[model samples]
Every structure is written in C-alpha cells, then in structure tokens.
Target: MEIRKATEKDVREITTIYNEGIEDRIATLETEVKTDKYVMEWLFQREKRYLVIVMEENSHIVGWASINPYSHRCAYRGVGELSIYIKREYRGKGLGQNLLLALEKNGQQNEFYKFVLFTFSFNDLGQGLYRKMGYRKVGVFEKQGIRDGEHVDVMIMEKLLG
Candidate 1:
C-alpha cells in the first residue's frame, strides 16, 4: 500500500472511509455523512497545516488520516487535533499506524509542536494505537456525551513533538 498526500480527487474516497467510521459509531460523534464539497473546502482552507493522507492499494483507498485545528486562537496555532480511520475491512492491517506516522512527520514539517486527539472510553483499539505511538492520556471527560441513550466517556490524549 502507498501512503501519500490526498488531493481534491481523493476527497470522495476519503469521505467514504470517514463515513464508514461514522457509521460504525466507534470513531466519532458525527453521525451525518459528509459530502465531497465540504471536505474539499476543508482541504483548501487548511491545506497549509491540515493534512489528509490516504493509504491506497490497487487504486482503492483503504484508510485516511487528518489534522485539524485544535483551537482558533493564534496562541494555539502550534497544536492540532488528529484523527485516523481505516476501512472496516482493512482495520487489522496496520494502515492506521502508517497513516498516523505519516501525519506526525507531516505535522512536524509544518512546525506543529503538539498533537491531540480524543477517543471514546470503549475504543480500546484506538486507545492502544495512540499509546503505542507515545500519546499520553491527559484526562477523561466523564459521561461527556450520550449516544443511543447511552452515556459515554471520552479520553483526551496528547503527544508532544519537538
């Protein structure tokens, strides 16, 4: 598989991969499916620091990773929020790790000093991936959200980069 920077043409497949993560209800709180136009706008607007990396094999997009604004304030410009998702069928293949490592390297090149992400308490796989990458759990927002009438906690994780 090849890991590379995503272009406008890749938005649709990236959206598909992200929607799959949303549908699974394990990776994100966003339930609405995204459109290519929206993702395209995001890519253009944040292209300088934000990234969309895709893992491709045989011309099929198998996974993606992204970095977004952690905060809008100027003082927080050096920090970014990250997310990585792989196609459901590709989950066990370490694609997420490859995508994340690429993002980290890209982030450092872009002058980012820190990366942050949050995962649901029940998402052990995601948490383990973050831990293996040297991310530390800084805090937990207890009962921070409710989905399907069930309360869930969110773990906040961070990794420092020089």
Candidate 2:
C-alpha cells in the first residue's frame, strides 16, 4: 500500500469511505452521508489548515487520515483534531495503525503540538488502536450521543507531539 497526500481527485472516493463510517454508526457522530461536491468544497476550504492523506493499494483507496484544527481560536492553533477511516473490506490487517503513524509524522512535521480525537466508548477495536498508538484517554462524555436508539458514551483521546 502507498500513503500519499490527498488531492481533489480523491474527494469522491474519500466521501464514499467517510459515508461508510457514518453508516457504521461507530466511527463518527455524523449521521448524514456526504456528497462528492460537498467533500470537494470541504477539502478546498481546509486545504491550508488540514493535512489529509490516503492509502492506496493496487490503485484503490482503502483508508484515509486527516488532521483538522481543534478549534478556530488562536490559542488552539497547535492542537489538531484527528480522524481516520478505513474501508469495510479493509478494516483490519494493520491499515489503521499505519494511517495513524503517518498522520503523527505529518502532524509533527507541520509543527502541530498535539492531536486529539473522539471514539465511541463501545468501539473496542478503535479504542484499542488509539491506546496502542500512544494516545492517552483523557476524558469521557457519558451518553453524549444516541446511535441506533441507544445512548453511547464518547471517549476523548489525545497524543502530544513535538
């Protein structure tokens, strides 16, 4: 697999992958699927502030990772909110780990001081991956959301970078 910076041409596939995450209801709080045009616009708007990368194998996108601003406030400029999504068929086999490592490398290179993210408390695999990646679980928001008619807690994790 090859990991590289994302370009406009990647928006469609990226949107598809992200929609998969939404459909799963375990990866994100977003419930609506994204459109290609919508994602393209988002990419353009965040091009300067975010680092987005995709993993391709045999010319097909299997996973993606991104570092977005934690907040618009200047005081949080060095903090980034992270996200990672892997296609369902390629969910395991270490792709998520690689994406996280790549994002960390890019984050530090870009002078980001830290990265943070939220994962559903019941997503054991995701939680384990974050822990294994050296991200500390800082807090939890109990019953922060409702998914599939059930209340879900969200775990907040952070990793300090140079």
Error of 1 at 135 (Å): 0.7
**lDDT tens per residue, model 1, 1-162:** 999888888888988988998889998888788998988887778756788788999998999889999999999988999989899999976678888889999999998999999999889999888899899999999988876678889999999986
Clashes of each: 0, 0
Model 2 stretches with alpha carbons more than 4 Å out: none
TM-score of each: 0.94, 0.95
Per-residue lDDT over 1-162 for candidate 2, one digit per residue giving the tens place of the 0 to 100 score: 999988998988999999999998879988889999998887788846588899999988899999998899989988999999999999867899999999988888877899999998888888889899899999999999888878889999999985
Give me candidate 1's TM-score against the actual structure.
0.94
Where does candidate 1 stray beyond 4 Å? Answer: none
Compare the candidates by TM-score and give the number of the best one.
2
* Residue 113 C-alpha lDDT in model 1: 95
